[model samples]
Target chain A: MPTMTDEQVRAHLTHEEDLSLLHEVSMKTAGVSRLEMCIQCGSCGGSCPSGMDMDHTPRMVFAMLRAGMRDEVLQSNTPWVCVSCYHCVVRCPQNVHITDVMYTLKAMAIREKKYRDVAAPEFAETFVEMVEKYGRSYEFGLATRHYLKHAPLRMVGMAAMGLGMLRKGRMSMKPRTIKGMDQLTAILNKAKEMELT
Target chain B: MSAYTFYPGCAMESNAKAYYTSLMAVAKPLGINLEEIEDWNCCGATEYVGMNLIPAYSLIARNLALAAKMGNKTVLSPCSACYLNLAKADHYMTERPALGEKVNEALAAGGLHYQPGSLDIRHLLDVLINDIGLDNLKAKVVRPLKGLRVAPYMGCMVPRPDYNNRWSDAEHPVELVEVLQAIGAEVVDFPGAATCCGGHMTQIGPETAFELIRRLISSAERSQADIMVTVCPMCQVNVDAYQGETNRHFGTNYQMPIVFFTQLVGLALGFPPDKLGFGTEITSTEKALARIGVDIPKPTEDTPHKQAGLPMPSCLRKNAKGKVQHAEKEAA
Candidate 1:
């Protein structure tokens, strides 16, 4: 057997060993998440307006996190269903940062490609692309591209509303790129590089 | 006039044009000077954060850096999402040094750096209620919206996770109701006042959004509200632009007109309906305005022909299945 250095062995073990899912999420979140303080009181699930739509309530998801069901937790639609309303965050008995944790979960899911639905991820990707490109969101471009790619049939249904918006000059024909595009791009690129590391 | 660095979010330039128009008309009369930030960028809304952290924080921080550079102490955002994103970034960066350092590193590339907590981030509603004062607003009302009944929908972002402890209550804030009452309008007891408006779920999960939208409209209709007054552009757009689709999905006709609170403020301040961006909402506000003796010109263009689509069968069937499952479990 090839002799492995202590540093290499520790690194291998760290990669192989499963860190507590709760710890991973809490670390990823900004500020004091206090996710580990959750007592699974079901307030988060009960408070969520989109709770019914979620495959698992946030309370249940936290329980699953404790059980280290990484795939099931990450693949669940609960994170995507979260609208970041912060109702649960405010109502949590443990004062857990529920909404911030949800954001962290979403980022992790997107990074791991473990999300359940493409629609939410795709829409977010498109929105981010526009913000990155023009430094402004082009509603006209976002709706057109999203609808064409995901729901062409619904685009027909949406035409009237689209036309109304267009007539009212609500939807711009072209995006307004910021004058400091180079600066913004450079900042974004640096941020992107830092994010990967 | 007290000056503020205005961050007109991306929505303000587009679908929420009415909000922009009305706000501009009312700001001067209210003794407020809204200085548009020079070359302000998007706040990344709710999406960019879900994709990456540093970039999302940096995107918002860039705007903050610019506002700081412009020597503005207060940054005012009308859009709820923008307000939350900006406040959240400022709060988190200040609370967590590692994040602040990383964000500043990225910002340094563009010659931008935000000193966390250097600026006071506030929502438009907050300013109208706190700075402008209800008493001052009441005094300026040239035309009282006495007969019009409006549901004060504050949406989710402005109140919750309030970093500065500005709002009274997160769950059921009285600020919107107070503002509407100040303008001499009847404020309905709206239960869905702080409920989620489904956000981008309308695009990603139409069925889910339709149900959430249905609940809000049903409650407002139950209260016999003439219109829903909202402080957030996303709330107005979701409840107004998607009302028709929500109705179609649920097989219910709900012609609930949603308007920006700023538009109503402009009206009470005696600005003409056209100037306040009336008739811009997808749900026509003609009948609602008629209640208060305000006659606005009808939109000249003919309504586009709508393509008929079948009602969403799965959502309906899913409700039925849920009932059956609950019954079975109870029996077991």
Candidate 2:
């Protein structure tokens, strides 16, 4: 995929133009009724730990979702960059589950294959993949794989810390596999099927 | 003695070994008995749920299901993310019948079933501070962490979205402070104690995560804290592991040490210092924890002591009304 140009990104900008996407998102998230009642108080933006990292602040993202700007909302980095701090959710006067809404948007973005920052999705995928595979994650292994896949140059910078951790026995060099992973697989498979319905 | 099924989470075995080790050291002293759940899997963290909800919850619920199978009603998780995810799924599955049915449907294939709300999922902090009571903790403090100023960093998850109203105040939770103080540490009024530490963003986007990490460290520093004590593994890893990178990113010389809350608790409990696993931190914790009598690594030529450090940046502090009040605004 080609890197998105600023023009291409700007062209996709949208507002509360439709109720369809908003309705869909609301159905999936708990305490979503407050999204519509959002006064755009900007309190969530103020409380956000990573607000500056996103192309759109969380308040604006909610507005965009209500505006029915699927293209813009799905293409946003807000959902991906949201650390699920709940600072915004806890602080929102409207009492909207802003974090849950972010989760809903993230699910939507993944399902639609829209990514504002591909590394976010990659990290989530790599992490979940490891958990699904071993029933537990190997930290150093996960970090090595993730960095190798996302930012190889950055791995060199992290080597010292990795070595430091390894020397201290703070990280595992090998994967830790649990027993009855087969049973876990059976349950997860059923879960996957259930999600489809 | 209350025996609870323990879910050590994935990090306990690997990255956050200090936390697991420290908790274990204090467990016997605190009269807490933890039976490790047989064949426990990952809690799926924050990532899996974003990928797919049902499977992720089922993945978390599977652990709950196993605990129930063991006839254990209380499951103790030391990691903040693990505790929250476990509580979240358990609470949601019960609250939403549809989700409950779907999760139970998945468990049925393994001849396992999780009837949400059957298990009492609690963070180790909750069990220790609230359950054990601060007075009992004071009784165990053989060595009070006197004259040590520590900032209580609870990260974002442990307090918020409180499924059971278990936490005191989500925005400004003082349980960590209460516990730390009971054990004889000077718990600073860290305004950003409950601030988000930007979990996996450090991996996905270093620049952004660094800023967030920088904010927490800076806030703690401004509060005149010697070290930052945290309950969450993610917060510890991000702040401790990424402190160097964050400093290099922001042109700052902050060397704050972030350690697990349980490690400090163990120290106060008079457990052998070695059992707490103190020296595993990437950032040197010697200077910060010296008052507590934990052996710290000798400072290298690079990290000097008794030197005046960079001034703390003026940042916004959370007011009583849950609004961010600027430092200057307060001062003026």
In order, what DockQ does each candidate have? 0.32, 0.31
Cα error, candidate 1, residue B241 (Å): 0.6
lDDT (tens digit, per residue) of candidate 1 on A1-197: 89999998887566545547778888778777899999989999999998998999999888777767789888999988898899999999998999888888889999999987788888999999998999999787788889999899998777667666765567665678999989999998999887522
Which regions of candidate 2 are displaced past 4 Å? Answer: A1-18, A30-39, B297-332
Give the per-residue lDDT digits (tens) of candidate 2, residues A2-107.
7878876565453334467777887676322356778888999998878887899988987777777888899988888888888887778888778877877888
Candidate 2 CAPRI category:
acceptable
Q: For model 1 chain B, where is the 10-residue window of minimal lDDT?
A: B302-311
Question: Taking the tens digit of each residue's C-alpha lDDT, what string does model 2 give over B59-166?
Answer: 888899888888778899998889988988887777667888888899888888888788899999899877788899899898899988999998888899787999
Docking class of 1: acceptable
What is the per-candidate TM-score for chain B? 0.90, 0.88
Interface RMSD of each: 7.1, 8.7
Clashes of 2: 4
Q: Which regions of candidate 1 are displaced past 4 Å?
A: A1-19, B300-332
